[model samples]
Target: MHRRTFLQSAAAVSGLLPLAARPSFAGLYQAAAVATGDLDAVRGDGRPVTLPASAIKDLAASLRGPVLLASSPGYETARRVLNPSIDRRPALIVQPTGTADVRRAVSFASAHGLLLAVKCGGHSFSGMSTCDKGMQIDLSNMRGVRVDPKARRAYVEGGTLLGLVDHEAAAHGMVTPLGTVSHTGVGGLTTGGGFGRLARKFGLAVDNVVGVDVVTADGSVRRGDPTENPDLYWGVRGGGGNFGIVTNFEFQLHPFSGTVTGGEVVFPIDRARDLLRVYAEWSQKAPDEVYVDFVMSQPPGGKGGIALLHVCYCGDNADRDLAVLRTLGTPMANTIKVQRYVDFQKSGDYTDARTMGEYMKSGFTTGISEKLISGIIDGFEPHPARSTGVFTQHSGGAIGRPPVGTCAFPHRHAQHALMAAVSWKVGDDGAPHMAWAKKYWATIEPLTSGFYINEVNDESRAVLNANYRENFPRMVAVKKQYDPTNLFRLNANVQPA
Candidate 1:
């Protein structure tokens, strides 16, 4: 997965290699030899706490998985997250192997009043999955996915990557709408309103979720579905990780042909404005099977900014729709072709990996207006050492079919999700890049209605409440009922009432 391969494959496709293709974590959990000592930790409110060496040893011995301290063999790697910009060391890291391990870890954290963070794929942009001098429940060792062809369903472990689900379901000629990136943790993505190539057709990942096995703040493993704990189920769909730690998810899968016509149509930056105007109108009428993204990026070391229309068409009328897109403007490069859906899902893996230091600001838009197009073009300033861009993921269709209050995700009427993003080298000074992104967002933010919770970064509680709208109170009630103490307050937090 080289940079050239990514560009040729359309780097905007959700990025992730299959689980088998990822690096092995075999020796990362050899915790038996690590000596236990008194641990200094922090409570959720930044208060200090300590666990006696005897208690640490007993807790380690209780779990079937490994308990990693700072001195452990793989502690360094275990603490690292996808965003290199976020560097925090937890007092102890618990690598859970199953639901039992998760329950024990949560119970221990609760008993000790230790600030707890949960890490799946470690792709949280805000670094909510990791914390300093706290306890981190790392799910890296729990990647397991099972697909039932007869039932057209996927049972994904809480720590499973989206790529694993894609691989397993594709084998059964089925698909579930997960996030855009294949390596994203299913737990964080689905709980935050998952969106991907097939989202328009099949709905979000949360929408497909039929049931969940979760460990709440009380360390109780509870099952939630329409019939069992329906309120909890509703809260989990779009309420984020505020309610509980989802140990397992049962998702309804849809039949999908293994192959689809998809790829990128790249145009010079000059044609961006006109093309966006055309896309604003054309995308509204596009069928459910047509999923597209408008991406603008100035690749590091590239000549200038370029606009790309990333297309994934599963319908029979791709030829007609694509022809219309090809005529939008003279594209500098057109890589559109028939490709396996699984392969397309992996196309952006290299790009995602390359952009280790990432900053993003995103919001849901009702439609692409002339003002937004102008704001995006005007604010986009290319940096020679960074990859900077503005992009839009097509929404609507199945996403809006469900009523606003059907689940916790309230932004059902948005037609597209717009984001301004910039990425630099891991250790480089990101201040300039972040400043640019914020300035760029300042112009477009006013045009947005609400935001997709997954991309939330540094937004205030007032903004969160406004975005959640009428559902905020209900989410607060669920949070109070499950996490009254706000144990899981790291995410797009819903403070308990």
Candidate 2:
């Protein structure tokens, strides 16, 4: 898709699409090809407490696949995340090659009374995908994508990263909207509410889903869709990793094509209020064909601030199309280049991919009002010297409106979303950023009540409950039906029956 078309589709998703029109996922979901790991070779015998080697032994023996106990050296390597602060200890780590192994692992965890946590790209701010001590089900190895071009659909594994999906889907001239960072796990983000550069045009990642392969607490695999186990399917869309472990996800793809012009445009931080006002006004009436996320970031050495705006044009009119910016302000640097959709997904991680640092985060207001803008301006004047401040980007043509009941994801038609994040070196400085993050957020919350579920930290308990609101109740009911014993209690929990 050229820049113009991409913008048009995005505009439809975020603004023009009817909420109730979400396609019903009524098809049967299939698991991956069965490998040697499909069979359960042994029975489990262990408890969450008493560290018994027998339980570990049984878990290993029962799996036709490989299982790594925490004591094993390999466990350390697989458990590491990009955030150094997220240090978790697991009793056992299982890498299931296929669904059968996942089933076995779930059953073992339930019967043996072991805590269960599932990891995708492991980008969760609160570390929901991993726990301090538990049974870790790492799906990072399940790299598979099957695209049906004629059907305009794709079946993606739970562990698949956005980068991989963007690369694969873009190849087909079809795309599924995903998060900003390509390294983010599609499962973790989609299971919550996925908003990507394409969101303004396409809708939530959950909105695009056709069906999902879910393993209930009973360890029995079933496809959740409108015609089969419909209730579970409803809950998984925006309900989070609560109902059960998702093995595969089927998505309805948007017609996407070739290179488009998209990327960063930085302006002096002093122009934040002006840019913010422009965003707020434009966001309300913006077409689905445009997606532009706004960011307020403090660069290194704390000189001043930057209005880091990320823009994507789905239409072929990059030349005459992007003159919209002149309405905003004089850009210090606007280097809009035409690049492949896959390359666009890789923009953020290019400088920091596979990098580790200490990070603290919170969420708040959509567009900064005069009051909030003043507070932000004041706050940026003197950030903790060792740390950098960031206000996450939120805006795009297609990201604005969806009915509340369309799916479990409730954040539709909301004006804006913002994340307050601070990243610093591990031992060098963690306290100042944490303190600043807390102070800044405390003031930011009065202006806004909603926040992104996937970008939270330790204090997000009450905030997340409020953020998703009524979706939680329905999620609980669905969780009861699929996992009565709460076997899949780890990660962003969906309470069981």
Candidate 3:
């Protein structure tokens, strides 16, 4: 059976069983307080805001979805985000079932000056999707995907997972460029510039976006496309979530066979420099249908660290295109074969879920240099307890075809997105792992350019401005027009000019 089908069946069975009731926040708050009653929350400026019991009750009644408070039954589970490192407690969580619910939640936040955070897949590396002592608009319950095969377009709900799109689109031999992880939220991934196995062949996920239904700071639902609301459309393509909540995304799909020749070729860590050098030269001249990434890491239960070339070829000349990679070094293992694209997309799901604490620093590189290859190899320090690696997400095919100011994402000329990532288990001191990641990134940072907004952490305002380059001014102008109050400032924020 397919993975998703099995999971759904398991979930249905689990739902038949009874669940335990946890303690509510009745004692902590007023003794007579109900789940959606009076609450004390924080404002956007760190001030206090009190919501009367009646107001809370009205807000809950106005929405079609459930409003969760600290005393709510599913509050614990609803407050959790994907990154285990982030531990935030929101005053309330509003699980919106549709655009109307989202608009109400946004308007409530705006009116009350509440610190607002939006959670789709809750996959923000910096935990921008959830906040403390604030209101969280959770979209987990709004996952719905509809594919128009005839039109070659997908209408995906904002909170939908990438795997659902892959599954639904594959049913009709269609696919959209999305992030590699199946569980990643389409809202965050596409809004912040998505990269994946098929990105080089098609383009960044933002490039495929045809239209969007967004709710801005004023609680207004607007359609953004080429002709209508053109500026808003351009901003939503690559401008992170700084403008508003994108309730729905319309993606242009490409005809696909549902299978691709792809897998990893692994070699010992000692050959990383040579393999990477070869990769730098070969990947530049590779066909648009090929996407290859270089990863250096120690696999679980392996004897030592290794260098891997993760290749995905969609064209007919798969063997011819991959021949140069095979001749580079004596690979320990080569698993390149034709496989279902959806299955390939889920290959890293288990590993990604196992990661409890992760710290990553990423930047874009126009071209890989010999010094960079040496620096990457020298900075790599493999620890038996933790997973640390330097990897590259291949770029520079159709991704660079768009002009710089065509959208808010300005890193169009980048050849690769490089990252230094470290992961540690739960209860482990992440300081050491994070330190190592930073040290490793320092060596290669100078040779790289800007960062991918989706993977960005705690970067300074000036650095972010510089990274956005010449497009920052235009982005600010759009921000001022759509969200003059900067209600959506939790992302790689573009402050209103």
Q: List per-candidate RMSD values in Å.
A: 3.5, 9.6, 5.5
| Model 3, residue pairs in steric clash | none
Query: All candidates' lDDT scores?
Result: 0.83, 0.66, 0.82
**Most TM-score-accurate candidate:** 1
Superposing every Cα of model 2 onto the true structure, what RMSD results? Answer: 9.6
For all predicted structures, in order, the TM-scores are: 0.93, 0.85, 0.91
Query: Where's the lowest-lDDT run of ten residues in candidate 2?
Result: 25-34
Shift of residue 413 alpha carbon in model 3, Å:
0.7
Candidate 2 has a TM-score of 0.85
Per residue, candidate 2 scores C-alpha lDDT tens digits across 1-497 of 11111122122112232212211112101011112232222212223355355555566666655676544445675676556567777656787777888999888777766677888887776666766556788886676898888998889998898888888787888899888777788888898878777777787788888899998778889899888889988888887777788899999888888576787677887787777667666555656666766676653355555665678777866666567676666688886788887887776653222232445454535555678766655665334343344454454345446667777877664556666666554455567667777887777768765666666566545555566677777776777888777666655555553
* Deviating ranges (above 4 Å) for candidate 1: 1-36, 300-302, 351-355
Ranking by TM-score: 1, 3, 2
Q: Is candidate 1 or candidate 2 better by lDDT?
A: 1
Model 1 TM-score, all chains together: 0.93
List clashing residue pairs in candidate 1.
14-180
Number of the predicted model whose lDDT against the real structure is largest: 1
lDDT of 3 by residue, 168-212 (tens): 999999999998878889999999989888988899999999999
Over the stretch 1-497, how does candidate 1's per-residue lDDT look in tens digits?
11222232333323443222332445534453345456788999899998887777777778878888887767777777777688899999988889999999999999998899999988888888989999999998788988899998899999998999999999888999887667778999999998888899999888999999989999999999999999999999999999989999999999988888988888887777877887888888899889888877676665656777888898888778677775776678888899999888877664334335778899899998888888988777876667777788899999999987888999898899988877776678999989988988998999998998877799999998788888998999999999999999889999997
Candidate 3 overall Cα lDDT vs. reference?
0.82
